[model samples]
Target: MTLETKSLSKMDFVYWTSLVSGGVAGLVVDIVLFPIDTIKTRLQSERGFIRSGGFRGIYKGLAPAAAGSAPTAALFFCTYDGLKSYLGQFCSKTQQPYVHMISAASAEIVACLIRVPVEIAKQRRQVISLRYSTSLEIWLHALKTEGIRRGLYRGFGTTVMREVPFSFIQFPLWEYFKQNWTAVTGTALTPFTVAICGAIAGGIAAGLTTPLDVAKTRIMLADENVSKLGVSRILHGIYRDQGIKGVFAGFVPRVLWITLGGAIFFGFYDLTARLLSSDQAK
Candidate 1:
């Protein structure tokens, strides 16, 4: 069913639809592009762009990512759309950009709770030369040795820092593109247009935030005995050690991954949401 745009209540069906659509989109995108993600992670890891492995075990941590992708994306879009609808009542159209920024940042915070642990597992598995057999094994081993907070949720704060600004920049830009596309073309924004906008937004966001991502990855992958380092310290260390380029270690692979992944993700999300709404109307 088509969602009534005027509805601001949390109980509205659109919120749930957004969750389902976002989840399905995320699942599809992560699964299809997971190998690229593996490569990107390896590039970003301490290995520093070395040829770790060819296509031998590219799908190492696909399970944990597949498990978490849906829920994380679902929570993100659900919170985003819900907040936008709720805030729309009080804010003028001129303030919609701020609303989008707030909604995206808030959504990322909630999504990170699920995302960080899965990411820790996924990245560790990706970097390892030896196969872990299953994502469960990696998680269990990490939990047993490093414990939950230090092991699984090690870079939670840095991740949030990376993600919040990423979303803040991305969603507003995505929305702006969508609005302008409609205004300029005098046609409704299609799934293709949404995908294009999402790609542009995701690529820019991912590129600009690579330094924070590098910090987050290093923190998460660090040995437990290593002293804890904040984002600033990690970034400074990267700069001091490898110069300016070290901070953007995985920029190329990451940009490629996020750009294509974002296109596929928002494409499917918009398509699924539109189909669901159409079916409901019928």
Candidate 2:
């Protein structure tokens, strides 16, 4: 049996396209829904939902998140697309879904390297009383005080626990929905369709992972005392203190943020890809 092979160089277009598109999509999503995310973080914080300063500083950490969103998203899609393309050469059509899953997982892991530090800065800034003016200041202070591993990447494990499964649940579901939507409607999958599918997948994934998210948030934003506690211990504390509902604090806003953000991220990504490819063809 002969397998058709194309030059890997052909994928250069996909690499650049995914990078640019993912960046744009991520930036838009992060900036637009930043307020919701602020609220969610506040809800998940150890301080509970009654922090001072009111809604005035809802966009407090928007800078770091917005700045990081582009690069993080670009890295994820670029890695995901590259891996998927490479894997496709070896895997049969029947095995494509598994390949996608593996690719997405790989992408998420790599993306986390960039994402974790950004999250550390963002979450810490969010819970504070706006003492720091910029994400850079927050990061520098944390680095000086807490050191790298403990400071900038405090919740790395918990974040991975939340995000990896989120990718696992989200990407496959998005693919499945897109395929089925195309089959049923007899129409090509458009950005709108991709957005809808992404929204559903993201919402489900975010909702399911809320407990892990709460754990991650607590770990990242924890003070010296709480920071000493292990993830299991912290989770046990949440359960012990506030019950099951506490474990899922900020579920509604998280779902809303992720769902809408997913829609915008995916929709813009697809739209950008289509436009880029069209330009290349012309």
Candidate 3:
């Protein structure tokens, strides 16, 4: 292979490997500690968080959270890798990094398109069954009661708005930080450092996109399925009722979980993939 092609292959090898590893780790986290994710989603929805009925309420939807999240994580990384390859055709030899960024962002956007709907169902089931049973049961109930089209896919448009830019900024930023930060520290990329960078990127992206997320949650939970609720109306309602803070409810857990979880995902994935690819290239 030519030098440029070799380099691109190396980077792509790392990139794809990191993402896939991260997906598996994410699945592990979602399944093992699903209550945290369920609570995070339920709190984001604000349908009933503070009341917390009890431990039962908090852990209401564990099973479905796993089912929904594990597969989505797998699909997300897979789609991201495929799209990056497809988009690579248009990238100049000199702009591989730029192309990488674009590919990662676009992959996330497409993944979000699918994710929002499943997440709506996942979150709704988590919220409604707060007083009841397992996440798996909730999943089946949601499937039965709400069906595929309306219930599961409640906030798809708004979800797109929230996730697209979030991924756009997050993935590239983490990679940039990982390489540079390692160089600066004169050590290999540690999980803690990677986690810190991922956290920073994730926190910024999550905060930046909170307004859209707020609208998405509302649309998902609305009795009428408020896809009709324009972005302006959603913002206006939150502003009028809850004010600016209302628009950003649950910022704490959202930031912390995403950052910590993101660190584990990206750091381990990158380290493992780079090692595997280096051996393969040899």
Candidate 4:
């Protein structure tokens, strides 16, 4: 096949492959790491961690997370791969980083449509005071009281803010890491290598964006009156009251959770994609 033909085929493959692999990866990582994520969310909540259930009910939000993780991840990879392929045609090799950033950011925006709702439900349930009997109940309650935009889609803007910059940083760095490793070794990239790169990139991104993340969690779990203060005001409030420390609440767990999550997610995704590709080649 010609290079163009090969590219098209790759994009075509991504449609199914990304869905399957991303779903599997997302489910595994999210479920396996639920407790850590709970801890992180509680830390970032406006309520103190001790007051937000502390170590109790770590899996309270598992239902929403389990339900949303697969679709959100699948959508992200499909959009990301498709965009990367289409946009790459218009950019020089040297400009590929920008293409990756754009692709990742776009994918994140699309994924956030699902992710924000999941987050709203999940984070709220993670806190004891905000606990709902079920994910569906959480949604119903939010919709009833706050409506869609303020309730179901609470924290959408802050989520996009946190996620887009995260993708911009993480995806480019991941691509760069993989590229350099392949160039230096003159070998095909492996799932393990991809995972290592993902871990590093995710850790850096998660650490740097902790404040935005804190803001997102707070917004999602906040009462209507408090949430109306908006991301900027909430951020300022946190900074004013607690200084830099409060802004970066949950920094440790956030970094650790994402680092491990990235490794598992990308590792499984690469492995599953390769398996599917090999099967197709037969």
Candidate 5:
């Protein structure tokens, strides 16, 4: 609840710590779990799971995902930590959850600038790997033919819609879990404990937001014309066509993937930040 908001200097140790640690966490978790993500995408694809190359070529989207994950996460934590510190100065301890929520929402907005394009290319490749030999090929095809908005950033709005609510749920709970653990143990939580908190929070958030995620995935994998129908229309169509089960496509895989990813990401982030902070103190 307390933050030392001395100033907004990017040269500060905490800034670099957040940037590097978040990057490392994001890159490692995303790459390790890329296959699970591929499965989730195929399951959510309009082409149907088996027809969309089910289990074949699971690493189809690794290139763009790897390239984008680090920076996007770096940007997220940088924005999140900085804003949390800056904004913490304006609120009471009881209001800290709102602080976390606002910071995370802002961070997600910033992160999505890069995440959306990578997601578009990544999901597309995951579902249609045979149609394109490389991730770059998909990116080029989208941009060249569809232009930026409808192509590379095809699901930008829905992604923000999904990610914002996800952050709203996950971050507040992650912080709350850490606070509770620290209070109960009379000591700060270790990276592993923090990770457990993250896994719990992330799984809950992912499960709750599966429908929004399904909409984002559907929009991305849908034809260019379908992209224009928007999130509401897409959701309606999915419900009308496939029923309630259709709206929650890939729910299990999504929750599973995110639970594992949250542990890796938050645990490594804490470890990396602690290491950097220790080195700075030394």
Candidate 6:
């Protein structure tokens, strides 16, 4: 008996092409929506009422978010490509993932993986305090104080909780949407169509995960003694203080952000995936 690494190894034209396209999609979304994302995140995570602000206020963390996500995006697509291919090969046609959805979902998981560290840095960057001046500086401070895991990767658990299911639901949904839509319309599934699916999926995921997301934010950003506090207690505290509406605090902004970016990010991602695979075949 012998072991074969290449046999186990996964890399192909479809994967590279999808990855390239997905990577493009990621870059476009972040660049276009960086401002909105920064603000939505801030509003979502902040306490004592959501502060209304101009585009500048909302996008305060754009610089670092952009910085963080540039590398993050590349890694996201690459990981997504590999994971989707592996998953697709093993899973059935219905359960198995396609390149498009896998790309979207994998990109998101990648986003989730780095989210905490980047988020902590982003949060610190926005606040004008003695602690953090920039992403780099904030990182240094976080490294010294809370150490790597606790400070940088604050919301590690919830990140997975949100990303995996969110990606799973979304990727397949998009692929289904593209297939059904293309068949009915007898036209290629355009970028716009893909965007619509991505947006819908993003909203659904966001709505479902907001409570956990809120907890993640509070734990990371809040000064509270996170250890003594349970997620339920914190959520109840929010409900008591701000009411049920407060739980869905950043819903509106988040929906818009996801909608706009999802369209652009995923629309291009699919298109690019097609191109990449074609190039690989050549």
The weakest ten consecutive residues by lDDT in model 4 span 222-231
Which stretches of model 3 miss by more than 4 angstroms?
A: 1-20, 46-48, 51-56, 85-98, 128-147, 190-192, 225-227, 274-282
* Total residue pair clashes for candidate 6: 3
Greater TM-score among 1 and 4 belongs to 4
The residue-by-residue lDDT of candidate 4 on 114-225, one tens digit each, is: 9999987788788988657888898898899888998899878889999999999999999999889888877778999999989999999999999899888887887788
Q: What lDDT would candidate 2 get against the real structure?
A: 0.88
**Steric clashes per prediction:** 1, 0, 1, 0, 0, 3
lDDT of 6 by residue, 1-282 (tens): 234654443365545565567567766777787766656556655543334233445455567676666556667767776776667667687765555566665566667666668877776555433245567877787678777776677666666656666676666766677768877777766667777777777766666666766666666666525623666787788889888776767677667777677777777877777666566558
Q: In candidate 2, what are the lDDT values of residues 161-263, reduced to their tens digit?
A: 8888898999988888987997888888899999999999999999999999998988887775787777788888999999998989999999999999989
Whole-model lDDT, model 4: 0.91
Query: Per-residue lDDT for 159-224 in model 5, tens only?
Result: 999999999999999999998997787877999999999999999999999999999998888777
lDDT of each: 0.85, 0.88, 0.65, 0.91, 0.91, 0.65
For candidate 3, give the lDDT of residue 47.
55
TM-score per candidate, chains pooled: 0.92, 0.94, 0.78, 0.95, 0.94, 0.81
Model 4: how far residue 244 lies from native, Å: 1.2
After superposing candidate 5, which stretches have Cα over 4 Å from the reference? 1-11, 185-188
Model 1 lDDT per residue over 42-154, tens place: 77676654544545578888989999999999998889988888887899999999999999999999999899999988887787653566777877877898788877677
> In model 5, what is the error at residue 170, expressed in angstroms?
0.3
C-alpha RMSD by candidate, in order: 2.9, 2.6, 4.1, 2.0, 2.9, 4.1
TM value for model 4 = 0.95
Evaluation by lDDT, superior candidate among 1 and 4: 4
